[model samples]
Target: MEKYMKNLTYESVLPFSEQVSYLNGQVASKTIAQNEALSLTLFAFDKGEEISTHESEGDALVIALDGTGEVTIDGNKHVLHAGQSIVMPARHPHAVFASERFKMFLIVVFPKKGD
Candidate 1:
């Protein structure tokens, strides 16, 4: 698996939200885990920060951990706050924007054989 945060040990209990930090005018991301079938990432976005619309090869699940944000999927916008979550379907256009400084967990799952 590919790890983003150096020196961070795995299989230990810790706060997921505190693992990544928000930076002014920038989006910060930490890859928790990455493999052929799945990828887990943590993100912190500053107010007004956004990820441009794009398509993914796998389905993406975004869960808000703190503050507010918006996820636009296939031209529709959905507002989200702490404890909220939304799924972006594979090969569909989607984007993420922070209404305020926010933290989130993103899990992307690739299609498996015989599914």
Candidate 2:
């Protein structure tokens, strides 16, 4: 068997909630394959939504695909407009809030470790 030719969409994934932090009615999807080193995800939030404070064990990158909002990371708040993104380092306190309806693509990188 071979890899590298698979396609994915949000509906193809399962739904899970995390207390780590997120706005009400938030939804997400992630894509992964065997031995995949990184995970790709899409997140959607309704207006006035937010993601609670939390830290990731792996590095995370978030790209805003639409809408506007403010993100507070490590006590700093920054505005995010369409086509903007931010990388949150591992173990850093971070959270997100949507001033309006919002959507984003997330990439979480996981380096392979020697057995």
lDDT of 2 by residue, 58-114 (tens): 678888877786778898998888789898887889998888877777777765665
Task: Pick out the ten consecutive residues of candidate 1 with the lowest summed lDDT.
Answer: 2-11
Give the winner by lDDT.
1
Q: Which one is best on TM-score?
A: 1
List model 1 lDDT by residue over 20-89, tens digit each: 9889899999887787788889899999999999998899999999999999999999999999999999
| Candidate 2: 10-residue stretch with minimal lDDT | 14-23
Model 2: lDDT to the true structure:
0.69
TM value for model 1:
0.87
Candidate 2 Cα outliers beyond 4 Å, as residue runs: 1-24, 28-36
Clashing pairs in model 1, backbone N/Cα/C closer than 3 A: none
TM-score between model 2 and native = 0.70
